[model samples]
Target: MISEATQAVITHYERRHEFRGDVFGAQPYANYGYWARPDLTLEQASEALTDLVAASAGLGQGDKVLDVGCGYGAGAVKFVKRYDVDAVTGIDVTPVRIASGQDYIAEHSVADRITLQEGDATAMSFGDESFHKVVSVECAFHFDTREAFLKEAARVLVPGGTLALTDIIPRRGVDPSAYLTGETTNQSQVCLDMPANAYDADVYADLLRSTGFEAVRIESLLEWTRIPFADALARVAAASEGERAEQISRMATRIRQLIELGEDYVLVTARRS
Candidate 1:
């Protein structure tokens, strides 16, 4: 069973149009697209971010990949299309997302190379060393515990298999307690109240090491990610009106404020050693 917070995250993606327009184009993906540079459009940035994670995974022909928390299957499809992977197996706790992802694979004529199923991150059903690479994008924060998910990821990966992802991290030394009392906290609680497992960058690296991963690389992408994402949200909000627009505006504002306070969006990659 999914936790309440995880359910909320799933529901948010199911109605993603409320915050972001059709980001997946003809495909379906559930994430705030990655914005690597200041000039790229929202869609381009998101795809670029996907490419970044895929590159970090170091995929090659005939490689089997696992996409944990694989949203609507867009990222898996994108991975196979962009890389030479033999197949991508994606899992998410949300049954609706799994169904939608399955539909997307069939609709896109990639069923042979893509599979999506409803599965948990903390305790996956896959056998040990099942994949050559494991990747996720912006979804692990919803897991009951990142440590458990990391252990599961290691268990499913072949020796030296890579694990790559983008994640949200609270800034080092920033007191979350301040968020409880500040006026803006209400607007930013969406980020502030992220799961306790959403640790700072250093702590996240330590967790990966403790989980049997090595060559850990963690990079801060605050300037390129949050700012551009907020800009995209603001642009969308400016073009619309009413409660939905207000909600988007608030989200955009909150992202900007979070960045100002040292909160970060990070890209993390490691190899299962």
Candidate 2:
């Protein structure tokens, strides 16, 4: 079962994105696109991040994938269209967004290749070795603990299958109270609540290895995080007005400070051995 706090976080995303159109509104990819190079546009960078994860997973035609924490099924749709994957099953704790995702998939006419449903990451409803690859993008921190999710991923993936995830991991021992938690410690968490589940890159890799996964690799792609986030904030400031603009500008400044202090977003991959 999804915890009340996590459910709130999912609902928060649903509400924040309710106004966006179907094109790029379902996912935060455009806002925080991965900048492999300086010239890439927000959409290009966002698609590239999906490509990066696909490369890490060695995805191919006829392979089945499980997408845990899939948000509104945007990334899953992209995967089916871009990669030749036979099918992608997406599950999210947020039930409200599932209908929207289903509508989008039907509108795009890719229903045969992608499916989205409301489900928890820690305890998924699937048989053993049900998928060839499992991917979760930038959403694992919301889990009560990554350990339970990783173990469940291992159980759901076939032997020698792959698991890939992108996450915003805090630097070890940093005071998360500075940015993650709100003005008060007991405040409701935001989508990017880092302190709620603090784990550095190394700790993540170690946990993956301990969870019966082998050849675990965790790479910090700070350039992607710092550049794209700054660019998005700049765009937000340019487009918004009043208190919303001010709020986003303040958020940009704090994120830059956190980056300088050693927090990073990373891509992690491993094989179930």
Candidate 3:
């Protein structure tokens, strides 16, 4: 149900991302944000690859942009620097993440061009067709409902605008309950992805079409994460063949695990009709 508590945990972790601590135990992404991750350097390469591949998506200068579930604002920074986007606004339901995102913007000296706020996906306060481009990075799955999220996204997009979403989706009928929510937390209240979610590539295409979007494009390159994960593990293994041989083997195991566990963090881009 994407309860407020689960959102709180996400938000809290982001706040601690800049610090060296652990609050969510040994969760995967619970490590020190991407910046502090042992794999950040390689991960950035992956993001750059995606940026280059999608560079022609037309995020022009002076465009008003909205980033849903901005999460520490890494992608927002990438967009401003790579795409010439003028003004970027990132909104999340978590105050901690909002604060952390804002801090990241200020630290990077992009405060004038970027902003972060706490917002609800089902109901944004922006005017009709307020943004020229809307993008979410691996975060839209947290929206209240797939339909409501798309509807509100459409409401905030102008004619000929675009919505590029990179979110985690379900695989098949696999019960995500064991992986999603945890003790003292219940995200199932709103997480639509279940036992088996095929990243909803087709479903999102259909929803975008129904919500006044045209030229929908769905790319299900789910192995991108594994590429970086394996690369990072290789780096770890390279440090010391004997010392890291076992660790590298574990990393390889983990990369395969990412492929098996998260085969749904897909990228879907839809243009507003």
Candidate 4:
């Protein structure tokens, strides 16, 4: 369990938003689109999904997908509908997120294809080798330990299964404690009261390998950051009004602030051995 203090901060933060994961849950683009549009163009949505699907190439018609820290269940629902994958199970420790995702699945009639549960990453509630693909989109940051999260991920993933994730990775070689403190010590814009151990690309790769995952690949999200900071800022400022507007503006400001403090966006892919 996360520290009670941490959990309280997380609960407060998530309860404020309709979605669970911070803005840019998976793709900075659609993430940016909350303020940009209600009906994002298919083109916009597909680009974000390109990286998402490419990471899980082996998933087939009947394969199951496990999404840890599933956020609002966008990737989960996408996989079921687009690939006709047999099932998508999304789990989050945040109760509100599970509830919101449940409502989304029910409202969209994707209930047959998607499952959302209140679960933990450090101690997953699933059978060994239960899923063909495992994904945690920008949510693993909440995990208190690297080994715990990787162990649970590897335990539940089938041999030769794939794991894909896009989250804030520390810029290579930087000490996280330097910039992480105070408000950051609680719930910084980048992560929620989370001191990241797998932020470094090499460190993340090493952890995956140790957990029996092979061929791990970690890439810094340099290209994505260039356009998003400005776009996100502009969109939030333009779309927000009254209390909601003020909240979004503050959140957007914090995201950019964290990005500036550390070049911390990373995309990782690995296979369960």
The TM-scores, one per candidate, come to 0.89, 0.87, 0.70, 0.81
lDDT of 2 by residue, 19-54 (tens): 333323334443366787877655677778878887
Off by over 4 Å in 1: 15-26, 179-195
> What is the Å distance of residue 266 in model 4 from its true position?
1.0
lDDT tens digits by residue: candidate 1, 11-112: 655555334446334546545666656667666777787888898889778889999988778788888887969999999876767887898878878999
**What's the distance in Å from true for residue 5, model 1?**
3.8
Model 4: CA > 4 A from native: 5-9, 18-58, 184-191, 196-198, 225-230
Candidate 2 clashes between residue pairs 3 or more apart in a chain or in different chains: none
**lDDT score, candidate 3:** 0.62
| Candidate 4, residue 209: lDDT | 96
Q: Residue 76 CA error for candidate 3 (Å)?
A: 2.3
Candidate 1 displacement at residue 257 in angstroms: 2.2
lDDT score for candidate 1 against the true structure: 0.78
- Largest TM-score belongs to which candidate? 1
**What's model 3's TM-score?**
0.70
Ranking by lDDT: 1, 2, 4, 3
* Error at 23, model 2, angstroms: 10
Candidate 3, residue 209: Cα displacement in angstroms equals 1.4
Q: What's the number of clashes in each of the models? A: 1, 0, 15, 2
Candidate 3 on 1-273: residue-level lDDT in tens? 455534654554454454312222221122112222343555454465336323535677888889887766766777787777988888877676677677777877888999888887777889998998887765565565656778888888998888886666655554455455432212112332322233346666787799788888876545554455565555655664563366456645644554566455556778888
- What are the lDDT figures for the candidates, one per model? 0.78, 0.76, 0.62, 0.66
